[model samples]
Target: MELGVGWTLKPVGFEDEEDGQDAKKIVDNQFEKMDYHGTIMELGMFYRVLGRACQVNTYDLNGDFYFNKNEKVTGADSINPMTITDASLRKVMADRTGTEPYVQRVTGSVGNPGTVELEQDRVIYITNNPFAKYSTYGNSDLNNSVTDLRTLARFPHYRDALARLYSQMHRIVTIDSENSYNIIW
Candidate 1:
């Protein structure tokens, strides 16, 4: 028998000057989700929650989410490959190196489109929209969405996910009897 698992890789870096010497620490990645995969009551439930966790964080971070691209993308570099983790989002880079102009500035001018400045940053994100509209109950949205999550996410209506969460969160839907789908904030 064999068991296989993949862990998230979080980037870490540091610099130090001690004892008349200069040194820097660079850890490419580390896993932060090891606990999420443990003690599952049901595989389906776990997968859905994991997917949601992925999606929620993406939006929370001002949609600054993406998958890995090059064999190596680092923060110290003037450039970063902030792709959509090849649609899996299993691997990501926030690009906090100030290399990107749009991402580095926190603009809040009067004529801007959105009133609130981006909390984190923005990216040309790609996702499978694993939370697309679907019947609740056992037929959670993950059912249809998972079939082609990558496809739907490639060019998502990012607002849809946020809208869905805002209107339907914790509110049980009666499927065909509901008109909440039209609501958006």
Candidate 2:
């Protein structure tokens, strides 16, 4: 682990980031891992700010009202949530502006802990697997389409705050300066 014969060896015991954890654990681990010497009031405030950030910016770039939105993102909590019949759904996801670039840009990026379930298709199903409960998936446009646009209002936000929270967490971790600590607020 040489660094051009200059800097000392990088610190060991870096935290392994996990997804879909309970809020208490998330905040506790986040605080502990940051090596912060703050009061619970400060920690609570941080959580509040982070929570609000997730809620507000979650839909910041949500683009449009379409027939099929909140597309079920499979393979999250299941081994094989997507059947072969839904292969086309994966492609449709890839074709979408919201998900396509994320897949491509993050495809081989090292230490990238994010996940995208579909590789291709354009269908929406309300049926939720443990992993893709929030995603839309199916093989037919009719099955995917609906009259209420708001129900399908996920647009670019994936219909929830998880994505925004993840992005915000990345910011907090990467730029944890004394001043940066309050950036989320």
Candidate 3:
């Protein structure tokens, strides 16, 4: 299944009505060229499975308005969460924080490594299950099921098949309310 994103550009007053419509057109055009829907789909999967996802913004106002617009959108580039080393967050409230500056991304191996600092305005950072509202990183959604997953992975072919078969079978038992001790299966 696919997810769709939508928004409206409300005019502040009657005088700015036309400006709102133009703004909406520009924003819509930008999203279409970038394949925003497809990008969002991938981002959602990554966020749920890996705990976080990111997409960097790029712009090209010099290009034509509508004609040959399909070539304009290459889709915002996504950064692998594994490579993200750290982020610079500014405290917005006692229990909340935001990323408005940048994040550190590492490249190459530990022995011969390189780092790229991406500005917050250019990079979008996403995280879930953070230890605190102010925490920067997020915990994976599968964290609680790790043990079950490991056990399933270790099961042999015959054992796994047997488990599946047993899962499909159910047993029902009946008990007499008056006697309480008598039971039927």
Candidate 4:
């Protein structure tokens, strides 16, 4: 995407410059530890191809749901978009909060499947189709080309068959040649 070469942290209005520098140092350290550049690049690839991407956050061994702006974040790992079954968004006006912001994924084989529900704070989710309000999953960038891709895939076989059909030679022999041979004999 090349939105920016690298990340920068600038002090907000009325914030101390030195404090901003310190915060930047801490963030840079975490970025290095988490391989943020590489992970983001990978996520971008998935987002382009599959129309959605996600990275699950890893926290310290203390406990689950330790998501804060401090040292709670240990690392981040990317998840395959295909394995993600569903994603729910937060409801602002619902009384019961219909569904929490979470992502459900399937793991293991079909014979022995496992479901994992990752809370919203633990995931960095990106989608190509963010305008769809009620949809759970993002639409693929390749969705429009699916039929064209299928035709492209079968083009080689069809072209080869047509070539073989047109390559055959049809020869016509006249009975006059046989009669001429007999007259010569």
TM-score of each: 0.16, 0.14, 0.52, 0.53
lDDT of 1 by residue, 94-149 (tens): 34453432222222456543322222233322222435432111233456455345
TM value for model 2? 0.14
Candidate 2 clash total? 17
Q: What are the per-residue Cα lDDT tens digits for candidate 2 across 115-179? A: 44432222222332335533434232233234323454656455455445545545432334334
Off by over 4 Å in 1: 1-141, 169-185
Model 4 quality (TM-score): 0.53
* Sequence-dependent TM-score of model 3: 0.52
Error of 3 at 4 (Å): 8.9
RMSD of 2: 21.1
Q: State residue 27's C-alpha deviation in candidate 3, in Å.
A: 4.5
lDDT of 3 by residue, 1-185 (tens): 22223234454554577887887788777767666666677677677778877776665576432323355435475556667655343321222334444545564555666766665556676777546654456777777667656666786555666567646654555544446555444
Better of 1 and 2 by lDDT: 2
Task: Please list the C-alpha lDDT of all candidates, in the order they appear.
Answer: 0.30, 0.31, 0.59, 0.60
Task: Pick out the ten consecutive residues of candidate 3 with the lowest summed lDDT.
Answer: 89-98
Compare the candidates by lDDT and give the number of the best one: 4
- Expressed as tens digits, the lDDT of each residue in 85-145 for candidate 4 is 5424334112154335454556465566777777666767667776864344577767865
| Model 2 score (lDDT) | 0.31
